[model samples]
Target: MASESPACNICESIISQTIQTDDRKEIQIARHTVNEHFDRLQRELLKELQIIENDKRKEISKILAPVERKEKEIDGLQISLAIIKQHASDLQTFLVSKQIEHELIDTDNLIQSIQNNSELSGVIVSLQTIGMMKSLGNISRFGQTSQSDMSLVRQKIKQAQAKVAVVTKGSLDHQHGTIKTEEGL
Candidate 1:
């Protein structure tokens, strides 16, 4: 019995070491899985954000095209008016002046229409990440590790049965004492 004590302690130490080694491997695998998932998620998010930025930029460019054309038209009209004033007769100047006035009014109306439509005013691009942010904030850990008591119980029962068998054999061979089972019978 005294010699069995060291053997039991050695068995327990081996079991503990094996469990710790298995736990370390499982933990490393979990860490790698978590990192891979996050890396994939980050790539997907950045791709989505880049696509949104490009789309918004295209929309803004579309909105600015007509305004830019109108600005050039206005500049051309002003240059033409200055040229006509310096180089044309009164009658020609008057006729061109009337045409220039109508063009200016049309340009003003177009600008007003653009303003009323709110095309430029309402061009807003924003990321809606409140839910994602909240979810991230709520995450306490990547994963959980748990030990089941059923396996431990089964192992202890097997160990106890083996000890009982050894004691039974010793008693039968040496006839030293009676074997005491768990029931104390």
Candidate 2:
């Protein structure tokens, strides 16, 4: 019985050690999985943000192109008008002046139209993270660890006891001449 106690203790210890080792392995695997998931999520989020920014930039550029073209045309017209006024005769100046006035009115009307259409309106960019933020905030811990059951250890102890009982019975039978070796000793 005293020897049996030691055997049971050894069996329980081995079982506990095995359980601890498995638990550590499981923890490591879980940590790796979580880290990979967050890493992928971060990459995806950054990609989406970049795409949005690029789209917004394109939209703003589209809005500004016509205005910029009109501004350059007006500058060129002013320079041409000045040259004509300084270098032309009265008849030529009168004709050129009429053409310049029409050009100026058209340019002014285009500018007014752009203003009225709100082409230069402000663009606002923002992230919609309320749900994500709430979900993140709700998380208190990455995971939880739990105690393993002792039923496996108990089962192992029982098997060890059965083997010990068989060995003891075999020895007792041999000593009482109820069991014999193949060759007489």
Candidate 3:
């Protein structure tokens, strides 16, 4: 058999010390027990490390959950803003069209108003004369002196006489019974 590995100094000393009072192999057996205890402690430390790692993972997931939700919410909000912008643009276009339509209507109304007020073709004037000749006696004759409404009739005749004597061509000649075919200007 191969020569047995020489014992380490500390093991040799433990062997000698224990051998003095106990069995010769008690030191080696006690050393084996210590190694077993160390292995148990190492296993316990590894288990504790695994527990710590699991707790850290749980905590990290908890911290990340809200972050993920907020990120998704931010993305959703951005999309909403983009859609709203399109709607806003459409609304702007609608308002502009309405404004243009209003302007067109206003322009048409203004043109109609301008056309109606031209300073021509205005000749007749009718006056209300309800109680003009109430005290007069009734007279049904045309050009009568005692007519019931003689005052109103006289005023309207005077106004018509003034409007017709405007001398658009010339004044009327004072020829007695002059016919138009026989007259020369």
Candidate 4:
């Protein structure tokens, strides 16, 4: 019985050592499993963050694209406005020069008539000429334009362009015009 007791104790000690080794192995396995799961979770999170960043980049580009287009349109409008101003200035200068030439020709004709006619006939002709000159003067002044008038015209053009720009901006940003087509093809 004494020998049997010692054998039993030795068997218990061996069993306990075996259990302890198995427990250590299980702990190591558990630790490895947790580290693997954490690594997978971190990779998935990084992938999700990359996708979110890509979506935000696309959204930001969408928002700024229209602004870039509008800036280009404004540049085109400015170029057109400059051309219009130059043309208006040239036309005004040409018309004023032609008016001065016409006045000089009329004065020359009146002087020739006075020199050819006698005193009494010249007086009658002079009275008739003065009446015609007054009507011509009225006709000439009817459509006369000055620098201030040109400026007013340019101002009106600017106002009209501004209104057009607003309308254009609306159309550029969103579809507005209705489609009109034949009912049947």
lDDT of each: 0.77, 0.79, 0.55, 0.57
- Summarize candidate 3's per-residue lDDT along 1-185 as a digit string, tens digits: 12222343344456456555554356567668869987997798778777776876776566556556655655665555566657778776566556555555655554465458642223333433456445233534323122244446445555555566555324555343365646755
Task: Give the Cα error of residue 67 in candidate 2, in Å.
Answer: 1.7
lDDT of 2: 0.79
Candidate with top TM-score is 2
Over 141-168, each residue of candidate 1 has an lDDT whose tens digit, in order, gives 7766777465575567567868898999
Q: For each candidate, what TM-score against the reference?
A: 0.64, 0.67, 0.32, 0.35
User: Of the pair 3 and 4, which is ahead by TM-score?
Assistant: 4
Summing lDDT over every window of 10 consecutive residues in candidate 4, give the lowest-scoring window: 119-128
Question: How much does candidate 4 score in TM-score?
Answer: 0.35
Q: What is the C-alpha RMSD of each candidate to the true structure, in Å?
A: 8.1, 4.4, 72.3, 50.8
- Candidate 4 per-residue lDDT over residues 52-154, each given as its tens digit: 7687677656645655655565565555556655776777656655554554555555445545753213111111358756875776322222223444544
| Candidate 1 clash figure, as a count | 0
CA displacement after TM-score superposition, residue 138 of candidate 3 (Å) = 99
lDDT of 3 at 17: 66
Please state the error at residue 140 of candidate 2 in Å.
3.0
